[model samples]
Target: MTVQPIIFFPDQRLKQICAPVIEFDNALRTLTVDLLDTLRAAPGIGITAPHIGINQRVVLLDLPQSNMPEIYINPEITWLSDNKKQNEEGSISMPGISAPVERSVTIRFCYTDLYGKEHTEEADGLRSICLQHEIDQLNGIFWIQRLSALRRTRLLTRYKNI
Candidate 1:
């Protein structure tokens, strides 16, 4: 498998709702590998499978790891913290802009792996943001979509090269 270019914003495929992954077979394995390659090639810490137009529920995340990258298939958020933390949010989907936003401090996640084994864990800090970001991609949403109308309008105008 090879790295595929990440889809940019306004790409209709990035707005598609992804379907659940039904099989733990070769196609799924290949997708995981492609995601890995793409993530590494993008040099990014995370990528959602649907963003590549596959419409499958999977996310490739490396969290800046040098070697051990984590792949999550059909991931779901099971729990979250009451307290929130603010961080800079941006996406490959919507380049050239970053915004500060508040997100959950901790999140519990459940997903299947490449081996078809189910796993569950809680994550905090940047990991939580990464998980939430990837999950949003699966839902056909981008970080900018979460912004207020004023902010979104400003962003769109900015993208118009302000």
Candidate 2:
């Protein structure tokens, strides 16, 4: 597997809802590997298939706490806590700019692994934020959409300058 070029912001593909991964095969495994490589190259903690222009519900997160990258396919949020917290968020697709976005402080989500095994997990803090952010990408909601209009405009202006 090789690192693929990231699809930059404003790309229509980034806004298109990704199709669920129906098959668990070599192709899916390769895509996961490529995603991991690209995420590492982008030096990002998390990335979605759409970030690389793939219309598939796949995400890879390489958090420092994990021994290796974690892959999630067809992930969906199952529960969100009433508590909220703000964290700086950015995207590999939209490099160079980030804005603080408020998200549920705790969340429960379900996803399929590369082997097609379904799993549910709970997260809090940065992990909670990352899961929600990447899941948004899968649903065709770019992270910026979570920002206020003024904040989004300012972030886009800064991105343009970069």
Candidate 3:
């Protein structure tokens, strides 16, 4: 149960893109476990390796509706629906800050599992929103960037007071 420290927002590392995981070894497994512990500690539904300053393209999602946590190594969105949906999105990096962000209604993505098995899956609703959010983090895009300039400023001000 290693709950790694999360890198908070405004940190340049959070905006830096992560490198793909090349070795699916014990270290990778350990990192995934640490990520889960950190996510649970943060009380967030999703997290990425970069959140902990690892700079690896790994994501762990434990949605409330999920039976178990899912790991996505080097995850990438392969397709997106034309339709869009607005959902409240936030990040563990910036706790106590949240805003409604528009995202694709459905998404098809591919990722490598812990065992190095490649898999593709499609998701919608909250699951879809989460996947896209985490992937964006992996790509060095903070969730707040999806917001409009005015809304982002207001959210930042609120976060500053928190």
Q: What's the TM-score of each model vs. the native?
A: 0.91, 0.98, 0.98
Q: List runs of model 1 lying over 4 Å from the truth.
A: 65-67
Q: Estimate candidate 3's alpha-carbon lDDT, on a 0 to 1 scale.
A: 0.94
State, as a TM-score between 0 and 1, how close model 1 is to the true structure: 0.91
TM-score of decoy 3: 0.98
Candidate 1: residue 88 Cα off by (Å): 0.9
The lDDT-based order of candidates, best leading, equals: 3, 2, 1
lDDT string, candidate 1, 61-158, tens digits:
88864368888888999998999988888876666777876789999989998878999999998889889988988988777887788988888888
For candidate 2, the 10 contiguous residues with the lowest summed lDDT are 64-73
The best candidate by lDDT is 3
| Candidate 1: 10-residue stretch with minimal lDDT | 60-69
Task: Report the lDDT of model 1 for residue 36.
Answer: 84
Task: Report, for every candidate in turn, its global Cα lDDT versus the true structure.
Answer: 0.83, 0.93, 0.94
